[model samples]
Target: MRLGRVTLALLAAGLLAGFGSALAVCLCGYGDGLFTTNTSITIDGVMADWATVLLDTDNSSCDGAAPGIPPQPDRDDPVQSTGRDLLQFTYTWNGTHVQTLTGRAASSTNIQRFIYYADSDNDGLMETGERVIVAGWKGSNRRVDLYLGHYVASNPGGDPMLDINGYSDGYDLPGTIPDLSSTGTPDYSGDWGAVDGVSMEWEVPWADAVGAPGLGLAPGSAFTFHVSSTNSNPGAASFPDQVDDNMGGCGGGAATTQYAQLDFFPDRNLAAAAGTTVYAAHRVTNLGNGADLFDLTAGAPTGSHSPGVAFFRDVDRSGTWSGGDVALTNTGGGTAIDTGTMAAGDTLYILIQYSVAGGATGTATIIATARSGFDVNRTNIVTDTVTITPLPRSSAPARWPRPFRPRASTTRFASKTRVAASWMPARSRSPTGCRPRRRSLSVISADRDQARWPS
Candidate 1:
């Protein structure tokens, strides 16, 4: 079977007992933190089939100088060391299922339980979206038991351990009768003479055990793994697992590669009057694996308008600018805005303000681009078009009509009081007290030469 590249880091700790002897133990350390394999794994309790799997070896006093032979005395008896002395742990996926193997010291008891946690969301927190597998020995015959469940961090009443009959959020899986053989050689053999540790192996369905809804285990799927062991039944209400020696004593490593990603929202269109300001609401979310800054820039307007543009942070996330909103300064070219450090999964709301030119008319296309600061190659862009229409003009005529005479014996004149002008008819009383009314008009005689005065 072919193997992928592996990375390892060693972390060790020691516990002293009555004799004051320091017993070195391996804490959960990365050994080939993330890797893939195509080899088929059998669930029979054996170690030869796992010889090629990446080994996350734990620290053991058996590797120390003057180490005792098989059936070594409990180094931390009264100190309550781990109920099961975890010596080695590793796992691999073969397209359909995940196979795991664990090794314990020869003197370790069969009262052992293992919990495998999967952080499928990569948020660095345990929640319902994540998965956990609990496997342990049960009954007088030491029958192997298995379970599949999720962690509910918000439910204070929820139990971290799995129940044999199944819980509200978990399922009791059929047992695989794991192989517990005492023929596995220690990966970290020091002065110990031929110490064949106890080996246990099991397998679980990939879809049922490792994958969560909407988050399946696939190539490039970023996730994390952590394995722990206890001496009590996994279904017990209260487990007294040895914490000082084996709480996180095995298989804790991240299983993903780092990358950058971003998303921009709200590509829109708007309408505004000339010489007025209009704003567009936008939001950017960081979807990468680590903290990063983003560069926001506006493209030149494409159309009849050359509107002034600026950007501001919606500090309150209200989608509109307020007194608390802070204006962002241009980094260069008056088009680029800088976003401070943003952690993974963080989101920021922004307002793009456009000051329409006084003479601007017709539509203007504005493009906003957001690029990851850590990797310029990763970027997202949104577009907005503002339609500028001319304001309505007054319908009143530029000037008032001229006054005329009537053909009848009586003569009358018409004038606009708002015009403040003088007009005289051939035969009429002095035109006075002419006030502007809602309905005012001037009528002219049909024959200009034919005119008459009051008799």
Candidate 2:
């Protein structure tokens, strides 16, 4: 029967103190450093735990240079313009959807509204992967209308696949718009509610933000967004005066903008032996908007083979040796490391060095979890498995193949007792892709020639 090299290694008799039966062990090094939303959010316009408020000072005017062009008051104007700086808002998210609340002090039947432009890929450019959410409060109907933009695969940077007028409760309408409030007009009551100068609320699901079926955005997914308010009458005083002129009813860049950051564990896995120190590498990637810091933690299975696991930051991307790398202190109870800070799009490799306790053997598994700030979730947990087998002792000389490369061969034995082999450290290139480095190797038996460990 064909067996793996690791299994063949177990054929030897009498290993050091820690070998007897097959065992498994896990080393959890990914800590809890993810920023996650704990509670769900309601679509109502009220500001709750999942919401953040934005003040009038946050307004972005389309007519910043010539305030009189839009006939809106400038920031220096003590009189305080009526149109510009007329609304304050709040925002929140709950993994599945995003909610917003806006309010103004004046009462009007027709209020000029704005839309949100999203940089989903966070590359600082609005392209095919990006999205736009058009939302506004219709004082005339005392309701809010939300529209999601679908990008044309052929022209991602061009106008959305569907025009602004393509608003409906059906999926066929350009992009899939949430069935907000009823379908048609005149008393549309789905995902929005509003009262002139009082308050307005709106909610958009994660599917709408991604623009397609396969592009689902989960918790810890982040991006940058800018809100721009527009008006038909340029001279009409608006909530916030634009920094630039609203040429020919054209809108300028976003007025209010912010970078969003989120955290989630993407990859983790490993393999090791009992009583032997094995180096395992786990990676954490940032899939958020702004820069963020991740706090990592882990959980290990209970067994006789207590494992000693240490986490080291892989300063270089190689995932091999180190250069001024930081070693995290174990927080006991399974928590192995904390990565500290990681920028968006950056990946950090966690080098986990673990060894099983002596005289212990059986299957063991380790799980690691990560969290950033208040973000934490069980869905991002990563798991690793370890297998341990007792080393066998042999009395005679035998031919052994290199590690990871198993071959069937016959040999003769002269003695009945297992021969003790001395271990020596050496570095060389091997068929196995292990990096060239010094590692532990069992080389000789009583009356046989010494064998070299695979590099």
Candidate 3:
């Protein structure tokens, strides 16, 4: 069961009363290529507040482009026409939510659909669970209809017409109904109504637009997104390119390439005896917008012990080494290893193993570092400490004296050797052939030994 869309129309109305006039007066049209805005926007089918937002202009003239199949006829004027010709598209974030506006060259009564595909995980492939927005306009209608839903197929390939499902209708937005009764026909039930003018505007919450938690878009986060205009024709119906051209299966068309963030976690401390080995587990994640490789390096240990350090990829994330775990070789000196390639939002478990030398003692400090393979400047580091102690030593003598003979005569023999007092027997002969009548033995001095005989 899918949840209904939370409408913010009342909230937006209140904000408009306070900030609408100021925004309209203060904001000048934005420069080309600018995509963000800080001003408040009202979704009243008017684009005055969006003046400061940049425009993503599509190929206006019909030049028989390869991707735009059937070649959009030269209906490049927004004031007149009957066909759906997308001229420009743009969107802006006002801190709380996003407002998207699209312009068309034709204003005559006709059916037009604007589709937005969001790659929330930024993995370059369209998988299930990512959101898509469809804004539809019929003839001469004042308001636009917005439908919110997620891709349903394992691999949607960026086609909303084929893969969108379980989507619910919002405030004036209508749910998409398939025209199963007839093939290759426009689903009129999916149309929201006609636009009052040449442009259409819609709003989406920030959380709902970006996607699931932890993978949401933030500052410096990069991801691929696709926007297209369609007239419901088969195969080559979309403008700016065919629906299947440069699709998610082909890595999508527009992706940002600046961010290459790597996250390393869980600094560790371990204890081990001399001549033993110990391991510390860790995890590294790629938080950027695209797939990237990371270089792993384990610094040489510092302190009393010079333990050998090795790195491994914990394939199962079991925290223990197993057959499936791969040993990372030293691509550079001093336990440096490579992480191959990791996709955006993907995490890899790692293990740092230390081999303690037989005579090693005290503490050894090992530093683990991860550097982005794409950008050397982007790196993360963590440390692991190993406390090594020597094995305990035995103080008891290696051998014990034989049983002594009892005698009536008293003879005492003293020596500098320190022996266990409990090992001495009463009225017995010493190991050196001296006999004692009683167990009263006293030390004369620290450096002196004496012998006494009594009959």
Candidate 4:
């Protein structure tokens, strides 16, 4: 090789981790902080339990300088993972053994639980046995309730994406399982590789969810839902016999949360005396990829406040209303309430006249329900309190009155209103592009028909 010793060292340093894991390579500080802070991981789909993984390097029982290779031979060889699940970091041990590396392995115990939320009424969480009609959570018996694929490919690259069809390395485990040891089993090859993970991608549907706990019914206006995923050790899940009945995959799961809500008169705040329309608004977001079929019911604030037209927005931009957004059938009250859909990124705008709950500027609260189902995240419970103030009943001029206009002798059935005289062709003659135009006119006019004032 033309490269000198110094060049070789630099080259080794650059190629050490690039050919593989970005998480382990770039997040080296994170790896070092592992013991201080629990390692970070996330789960996309539903699975049985929490998943787990671990890392180690330089075990003396390991043969040669590295695992799975002959003592230094060919530069161009088949791209394969060394038998050991190790990270490539050039560090010296005990001030000796300087050129060695680190072994990085994930255990099956990384993930914990994937909580499916109820979507029927806006419940963001999932229950058991419910099938998805819409929204994020379907039910426990659903495939997402069972099989979840796992992979070692951490980033959202070509094959390893968050979607169900995502592929990692080549195969997928039901969930993230630990690596197989020295004997080189099927699930133990790639850093985060598995067998059962691949098949589940085709086996489940994560787009929509169901309500296992009598959820996804009707009549109720709003609800919330929640979702979670877990990981664990792979070695134990694959070869239980090898690790003395070891359970596999990451056991603790990482997660995220989001929601939707409604309000009567789902728009800007308006202050009306006793009988002014209050604009209401209902807003919905996917929170997840799943769509929601929401059954909503609303109770206008209980008070003497007058109620008029209900305000709502067309969330789907479909020029109509539908779905889990704020909607209702007025139960014979101050005002008739209407229903509509709150599509993804859509807002339902509603304007309804309401009587003041009390007298000056107070608040009114309304409750939303899915009629039959429950939202797990409690998102449906979002209430928007509106300010009700005394209506301005006194008639006032829309614009400021002119301060005593100079008298003019024109009798065009003139009323108390006075007009100030100006020039002919008026402001209309001003050439409007960038520069101001000057006009010549008479200061006073004796004739009504041909008179030009301020000429």
List the candidate numbers ranked by lDDT, top first.
3, 1, 2, 4
TM-score of each: 0.36, 0.37, 0.44, 0.27
Q: Per-residue lDDT tens digits of candidate 4, residues 1-455?
A: 65676675554344333323211221211221112112223222221111112122111111122323532211112213222222222111121111112222321222222212222323322222233111111222212223222222223221211124221111222222232222212210112222222111111222223321223233222222212222222323542122111110111111111223332223334445544444444443333212333444456564434353344444454433456334445432323332333343333333232444334456555554332111333334335455666554787688744343323332221222333433223343234322223433442444445434342
Backbone clashes for every candidate come to 2, 58, 5, 152
Highest TM-score: give the candidate number. Answer: 3
What C-alpha lDDT does candidate 3 achieve relative to the native structure? 0.52
Model number with the top lDDT: 3
Off by over 4 Å in 3: 1-113, 118-143, 146-200, 203-224, 230-253, 256-263, 271-276, 284-295, 300-306, 313-349, 357-364, 370-379, 387-391, 397-455
In the range 1-455, model 1's lDDT, one tens digit per residue, is 12333222111112211111111232233333334355655664433444334332322112111123222222222223333544444456666666665544443335456665666655444455466666553323324555555554434333332233212111112122122212222111112111232455566655542232222555344444445555644433343233222222222122233357889988979888988998899998988766667889889999888778888999999887688988876443333577777777899889999999787789999998998775677889999999987678877676644354333222334421132223333343435323322322243453433333324
Which parts of model 4 are misplaced by more than 4 Å? 1-269, 303-311, 314-377, 381-455
**How much is 227 displaced in model 4, in angstroms?**
20
> How would you order the candidates by TM-score, starting with the best?
3, 2, 1, 4
After aligning candidate 1 to the native by TM-score, how far in Å is the CA of 145 from where it should be?
20
Candidate 2 lDDT tens digits, 1-455: 45765553442222101111101111111123222243464565432322212211222122222233333322222213333233233344565665555444343466445445555654444455455555455556655655555332234443332224321101011222222222233121343443233455666666643333212454445554444444432222332243111111012222212232443444444444556766567776766544545666557665545577667776675666566667865332334346665676777777766677666677567776666532444224566665677777765546443565323333233444333343333453554433323234344565445544446
TM-score-wise, the better of 3 and 4 is 3
